[model samples]
Target: MDVFPDFDGMRGIGNLQSVAGALLMFALIIAVLMLIVCAIVWAIAAGTGNYQIATKSRNGVLVALGAAVLAGAGVTWLNWLIDLGSRL
Candidate 1:
């Protein structure tokens, strides 16, 4: 019988789409909170409160957000991989 070469690719594409959609939703929520925090940080920096503090906080937020997204994607991918393997 004729057959598909890469079942994993199909699963991967689905994972990409699913993760991206979830990320967009997450981004909307993150945007609201980050908007306020970022503004506060910038204001503090502009007001000469602590330049390094503002920079460090900004970097921290980025790392936190990135970690969250990466965790989400990793979980999604692993779940999909397990499900796919089960079907085989």
Candidate 2:
């Protein structure tokens, strides 16, 4: 049995695509901003001899980096999956 997405069978898909694109853009922007803020906070905390805040901010930085990477790669990942499915 052949299984694949029927993009043309859906209505208002263009709206959904636009919304998805906008959301991805917002996510990337937020992730970058978070990364910057977290890095600054980590630096300040470390410089002030605050290990607790420094650790937390360090974790935040990693999380923000992950979020940014995921957001940036999500579209390419999805497309790759779709292409693989079509070949199956």
Candidate 3:
């Protein structure tokens, strides 16, 4: 009696890989766009001597960068964690 049933038959699932790839591409594009926008805002605020706006824009840039980094690493990290858990 196997506690974890064999899932070998489900290896050839639907087009999930393609879908995940597309979504990741979309997220990267959006993150890049947001970064550009934040840069523009920061530049404008700096030129206008609006320290508050510049600060906010700087924060936005950091957040966008963090999001991009997380998005890129998320899948690999998740897979690693799952593998570790299975070994436990």
TM for every model, in the order presented, reads 0.47, 0.76, 0.70
Q: For residues 33-87, could you state the per-residue lDDT of candidate 2 as single tens digits? A: 9999999999999999999999999999999999999998986665565556545
List, residue by residue over 26-57, the lDDT tens digit for candidate 3.
78778888988999999999999999999999
What lDDT score is found at residue 28 in candidate 3? 72
Residue 21 shift from truth in candidate 3, angstroms: 1.5
Model 2 error, position 8 (Å): 3.8
Query: Which wins on TM-score, candidate 2 or candidate 3?
Result: 2
lDDT against true structure, model 3: 0.76
> Model 2 TM-score?
0.76
Worst 10 residues of 2 by lDDT: 79-88
Best candidate, TM-score: 2
lDDT of each: 0.66, 0.85, 0.76
Q: Each candidate: RMSD to true structure?
A: 7.8, 3.6, 3.6
